[model samples]
Target: MNTNAEGHLARQQRVGTLIDLFAATVEEHGARPAVSDESVTLTYAELWAKTEQVASGLRAFGVGQGDRVAIHLERGVDLLVAVLAVVRTGSAYVAIDVGYPEQRRVHMVHSARATVVVTDTAAQDSPWDEKLVTTTVGDLTEATADATPVVAPVAAADPASILFTSGTTGRPKGVELTHGGLVNFATNAALPRILPTDRMGQVSSVSFDAFHYELWCAIAAGAEVVVMPSVPELLGRDPRRELKRRGITTMLMPSMAVNHLAKEDRDAFAALRVLCTGGDVILPQACREILDGQFSGEFYNLYGPTEGTTACTAHRVTADLDAAQPVPIGVPLDGCRVHLLDADLQPVPAGGTGQIFIGGAGVARGYLDEPAETAARFVDIPCGSSWGRLYATGDLGRLRPDGLLEFLGRSDQQGKIRGYRVEPFELERTLRNCPLVEDAAVLVHGEGDGKQLAAFVELAEDGAPAAVRAYLSERLPDFLVPATLIKIEQIPATANGKRDNEALREILRDDLHRRERYQKPDSRTERYLADLFEELLGVEQVGTHDDFFALGGHSLLAFRMHRRITRDFGSGLQLQDVIRHSRLADLANALDADPTGRPIRA
Candidate 1:
């Protein structure tokens, strides 16, 4: 918790663009393995050559400074090449999620005003192909092999990437990040450094800011980047085996996955040399289990918003750390300043909770094409000796007497579900867009890993909850889709005409009791499954018809439960059985149908 003013200043003094740092790394470690997937491995020199070829292709097609190119490909070598190629062409890259709904993907591309899209999907299959130029990874690498590589002048303040995050206005806001911000993170000494000998795992979806952090940090350090499978798939299998097999030394995971893995397998991180978890509140129990178990590595809790780069602060977990107490978000990263201020924009008294304002080299260049919104969040604030720009993170926090920062949740309607930022207003807006829904309200419920979205909707005529949920599923990502949906006659409101959230919660509580009314387990299989559900989900008196997801079960937890069931019941009970038959009676029936089978190793 000690603030090293001199050290902080020294770390902030280094200035250069990502292009500069990556170029230097390539020269230093040209013979080392730079990036690899299951299919191929590319040395730093080979990666540089491939990047240069792709950059030449983009330049040949008129991509250069001040242009935005959308990269809409899955995570792998091609995705990495496309991003680097776009940056090499001196154009800001816009990442569009391949898994997002067509409407959402189109909105991101059109909203960013991208001049070209680099994707392998055919133009006929892509919805955003109209008007914009389309190219492929194969075309860029093969067609431009003989072309001259572009050498566009790079600057620290130039835009590098634009990442879209969930917004309360029902539209995703594009946060324009600069080369300086990314360089600041790569050069920051406060973080646990990734050595050239370490093999860092890349797991985050390309659309997320964490993807850039995972990729650039390792690239800048000349470390080996091992691109892993999707997060869900990794969690479903035993991660320790895979990590050890791949020789992954450093990685960052969502708090939900961290907690679940920590509990499911105490030796989950035995093979890792450094583990970091954030993006949501870290569960104390998970921290305790990991630190007390087989993880013999550095552990940290990183905190920040997309507007403040990937991470602004970090808390290192030590042997004497008390899991019972709230974990501090720790001190600001080098070159960063965290100010806790009141509503009047004045600094709050020491040890008082206030809105968190972050000022640092990592602060973003503001939202793209929205001057009003940009001015609202990013403002010029007082630094120590001079005035500097600060992003007003709506998150609330307080500095402890020991100088560590404690996160106190958000001051706005936005919430984090399984590490993904979600705004209930966006979900509500999407719900209202459905013809069956007359009106709707969405609220985040539960705590820690059990947190979920619950939606209440008023039907237009003979609308059903299932049909409305299906409608939302087609439009929103799986995480944004509400886990629990209920039909309501009207939205509760107070006398002041404001939506009465407390009343809505009360209704939700009552409805939960009515819908999942307790029914005693009728058979041995049912009783065993019921007890397991209660133990895993921390719910009391789970009924036969009670659904797992409604009872606060998620994919990671489902994987853990699946392992336990397979270990005790039989291997015949596949992981999909738990998801498909989430009800207690239904799962019990599945076990009965396939009673005799081999047991799966835990």
Candidate 2:
């Protein structure tokens, strides 16, 4: 083993500390390919030269130390070059995930108050960039008047990048990472295991902090980074064939990878060497699947947040997890420390659950420009002898008897249901264990006075909503039972692969409205009204007009009503027909006029 203390000491250095590594790669692997995607391949020397040119171009635009630059581009060579260029100019790059909604994109840009926004011509049309200084990839790559490279002085503590994280409480917060912090993290967590002989798969978007590890880990170690293009099919398609095609030896992501493995031919990924995953709790079943699958690779679980660089705790998944209750996050990376503390920041007893606190070079500079928020998260290390502070991960976990870290759910996600603290993840875990459910998400709805649990689930080949409801009723307590159960083809996810709770909440809100739209009927008119409500609302039960929105019925639902009436009942209902006839009884007259014998109008 190479015994060098340089990697450990480098964590305290400033952001520009890795400039030498980039320069050295160009000289040593000048002709060797560095980044390869379907459209282009760039050698280390070529990439270095282009990065220098882009940096020079950026400097001409006055980007310098402490300046924040934004890159709103797709996953491509140009995007990589832009990131490197900003770093080379001694400014941190704020990656804007192209998939971000206009509002979130604007929030990130304005929050950063970026000096310049680097994007392509296609992105300039987006309304979000209207007020920012925009630069195109075409302009940066185009030949310009001769300009000298501008070098800015950088310290290890200086901010190198700002990663925006979508927190559950509010809008996204920017996590500031120093150059030394990232370099140290990459060295300790990635370099020791990866080598130049490895062909690594880069799957996460550049906007995510995980991509930072993917890109730099390869470049710093002289390994080849295979850039996978972002395609709709690739997002939901099997990656096994692609992984094998590129000879991809390593990849890292959350448990979602299990979904991909389930769909692909098992033999396709037989060549994979190392598979690292994290972001959320990995199910025990998923762990068993990987072990029994085609890839004979070492699997590692990395745990941390954008605020703690890439990751602080790691657990190498061995065969033991196949029989364990929950896998531990393992020991801390070199130069880092992990602590499980109670509400008072006091160390908790071994085997007792507590908040996980991380301290070391991995901890970031906190949310950018949000002083109060920064102070709240970056608390002083009360139990450690560290020179710096510790970051309260907001994640609830505990230390195992073996000193390994076992992650519980988020502290904030813990909510009271019927006077008992209920963790949504716990319910979700139970739902998933039924073997009939493919995936499940539980959300606590309502406020202050009346809170209830709602569950949305996607079933396996052998399950249905009714069966799942019955199964949960038998396995869980009455308080833990969901008020509403929805069955979807698949659960939508945020760009980072986490369950989109907001979206699910909207679905539940709609379901509630649908339930109240139509009441039971005592007469033929009322029965017809209930049938109309069911057909119009696309739900089995409806009680009243006040509940239309809760049933997932929107303005588009109005259009369906208009079409149904026009076709079956002779009434030529317009778009406004549904709005005026919000109640089932009010709409029943229109259906009566257009009776079943009438020919449907266009």
Candidate 3:
């Protein structure tokens, strides 16, 4: 670690502030292309001029230092310009994805108390009524066309932006990042590894915090930030083809990179030089596959929360994959410190697992308007080496003998089953190692009194659900084996691209109900019910009276059940018929009714 006082100060002062750093970049890389998409490309000079125009327009709309401007728009060159413009005006930009639900958008608008909104004309119908002043992307473009360029003075500690984390449990919380923190994180922690000539792939939506790293890393390094439009197939297909076409030398997240590398033609990434994979736990298997199969580029495993301004600790993956039970999270970046401590905030031994705490300049101010949560996670550490604030990550991990941190599962995610602590991430990693499994998610199922483990897996090409289940049964202990394995074509993801556990749980609940309906059959209708249940639930054994919910049947599965029953049993079953006769016995009895029989008295 180079801690030379003059060198540290130089690095800090050079990239010390966001607005100043951006202005300096504009001057240095004037005519170079800064951002490019299919529709448009903006050179550094053009981007600077446009950003000034937009900033001037925003200033006219009463947006200034500390004011929040929520930008609800799709991924495009204009969105990049808008964000920079907001920062240039000394206002923090809050990115809200256009695909977010109306209620979520409303909540974010109200939560951030945004003074202005930048969106597109197509997003005009969004539920953003009169709550804040609105400016369309088109409007900003036209309005800023002729405005004079003026650099706004912003301090290092000034709030640069506020990004909302994907709210799985409740409403999304806003994370406020300072310009100093972001610039420091980018220049010292991220940019050193990125080459000036590299063209980096920007895949995540702007709403995600990862985008902040991707966008800034490119501009600060004078690298090309290639904007990949969000397409359904792009999420599911090989990203390397497009990446290679654009000569993408660096990528930020592992999801797309891993998926692309898993393809048969791994030679697509031959030109790639650096790949950073994070956002979720990077399975060792995925890491090995990347190293062996596709990328010969430098690979890093990055870990951090949104409040930490993208990433705090990064580990450069070595060739040794089988040596450790879990990969090390690597050492902290420049100006950052990682501490493992007990409940009382005392430092734990190197080999013992403890809650990981992060301290340093990289840590953000705290969640916007969430003072309680902010205070709870961010605490002053008085007993440590020196005076500084530390954030309780809620993540459990241990420091290796070599001082590298190895991440254990989340403290909250650890559960006791049969007097043994179980980590779902371990199970998920094991399941993904199977050749036939494309992806897997494990969730604890059933009511409290009868809870059991269930797994939902998406099979690889030419793979079957039963084969995946059987394979896992062979590798894992009996208790660890998923009681039920449901296969789907694809795993659904949230707007931010993390696995949608809530959606998966809903599917499991529906499955349990369908299974219950199959078990309690009262008549010969059990036969038809069994067949329909097997086809609908994608499971082999379903009794006549089994409840749909018990079988992990969800609304989509229910609709599929209705269609399959109606198609199989002819017009004898209607959409209402399936709902009315939810159980096998009830449906069979209904089928047994004679058309000529007299109607019973109500």
Candidate 4:
């Protein structure tokens, strides 16, 4: 840790894998704190020693190089140890988010064909127990008590991790990443902003690619990576206040999270020295607000795919961000190449939108067990230099005249919601899998700035939309679940046997503008709620059945709506109610029940 940037670079140059770089950090500063959660802190030496023991135990348990080891633990010291142990064994780790349903976890683990699952004590009896070996983090000490410390031989090209993301075919695909790509990202992109003494919050969900950026880069810098006590709550006392309490200096938040924070916590936000954000497009208004706030931190807009080892491009947001124009995604990382290509793979001129193609050391080895998809997406660029295969990002963006790149929109059906990449086919396929569902069409609906998932479902038998939503909730992650559900007579189709795009749009438009459901104020409470919902959602009329999120209401709007409800009616509507009870009917009932507007949490 005493080494300067030059010496740190030299050490990293000698290492081939992330584990090796971590080992170098441990050797240089064994006593410095490397990782911590609310309850415990582990120094670099302690982490390395524990990881070696766990690696030895893994070897004793028949874990070998390149084997897939599923880490299903929560965000804590044990989770970090499991990840390091897998790396120390030269095995690619598969991260399973703690809150994911068993079905989703099963699908991901089966897809990766993971040989072992390291989880907490409660998850020892998962459905995959018969197919794979299971171990609890609590038992790692005992299991490795008799085993000797050892670091397995690792190579630069060996598979380092397998991150599962949404697939068009309804199943999640495992994106295979290599040690080289991981190291390249840390060296070229992350190191410039993070330093040895910098403390960054580990705020990203474990399954997300951003988590990798937050974890590995901090380890490379010998910086403390504190586990956020809450998920994506920028104004919370547990995580946000905890970060400030611990004097955390840096963090990489998603754009949505930053946007929400900008609205309320100007004083709290100005505390950091480095803040990097990007997942979907950042609203210029939000960016300008944050930049013009109390925070003087370096704010960056990063863009990339899981296939590009986290981020391939980054731009430091300047004070010139205007509401009329988009914040640029910026230039490529050092040693990375960005190609904005047309349909024919020809380079598009500057200021012309094209499919983003990344070619460089950061390009991953494509999806696992899907050779056709791999070949289709990761194609060889005809005019590429020694960069090799180019990863088709399937995102449209243009190179600005100033050498920066501005993101447009997705060229495919995939879209991002709350920073998680989602595909409608995945939700539609899950809907069709339901026993009563005969036909379904999942669409991304909304205009200007954001989108939300909607499902127009036709069931064989009489079914409730709420029931269908609940069933889907058991299989899909919360972010992938559609905020709106529409029951239909049948899925409209054209002569070509495909979905009738025009008809579907008409259906959506009619639902939005359905004048039949519109009624005058029935009561004082109803009038108040209707006016509030209409104003917050920017809709003309509000029906009791009209959903808030379906009409383009997001977390930010929900917060604003809740604030007004409290001030106007003297009813302290909780934030949870606004987000969860999005229906006017449900909220109206809640409001009527409590004069204070306080929900009972039933």
lDDT (tens digit, per residue) of candidate 2 on 1-602: 01234655553342236575576667777888888787888888888878878888888788889999999988777888888888888999999877655655777888988979998787777765565678876687564335565576877687888888644323467889987778777667433387777777887767666787788778776777887844223433335667777788877664444323433333435677887776656666667766777667788888887788888878888766744587677778777777888988878887888888888777898888888888888988658444448898777887776777788866887554433345677678778888889888888776421456788989898888778877776655444667677888889899999888889988877866655554465445446555665765455765434334334344334444554555455555555655676666566555555445353333
Writing each residue's lDDT as its tens digit, candidate 4 over 1-602 gives 01124543454468779878888889987888988988999999999888888888778778989799999988888899899889889899999997888899988888899998998888888788496889876576677876776757788788989999886766799999998888877766433568878887887888989988888888877888888754434332323466678788888887776765665554455668888888877878888787777778788889999999999888888787766888888888765778889999988876888999987778899899999989999998775444357999999998777877888889998988878889999898899899868889988877434577878999767777878888987888877888667788988999999889679878877776664476565656766777788776667778777677766676656766776667565775577866788878788877887766543221
Best by lDDT: 1
lDDT of 1 by residue, 246-289 (tens): 99999888877887888788788888888988898887778888
Against the true structure, whose TM-score is highest? 1
Off-target runs (Cα >4 Å) in candidate 3 are 1-9, 166-169, 189-192, 231-233, 255-270, 413-602
TM-scores for every predicted model: 0.95, 0.69, 0.70, 0.91
Ranking by TM-score: 1, 4, 3, 2
Off by over 4 Å in 2: 1-7, 10-16, 128-131, 143-145, 189-192, 230-232, 259-268, 384-387, 414-602
Worst 10-residue lDDT window, candidate 1? 1-10
State the TM-score for model 3: 0.70
Candidate order, lDDT descending: 1, 4, 3, 2
Model 3, span 1-602: residue lDDT tens: 11123554577777778887787878888888888888898888888888888888898898898899988878888888888989988889998766655655777777888999888877766777576788875677677688777566788888888887632222367888999888877776433477667787787767677787788878777777888854222433345567777778887764333433343334545567987766655556656666776567887878877777887888887688763366677777777777888887888875998888887778989888888888888889864547678787777888788878888856776443321234566667777888888788888654311335788888888888668766765654434556578887788899999999899988876875654543443344466666767765565667765655445443334545654544445544555556667766666667657343232222
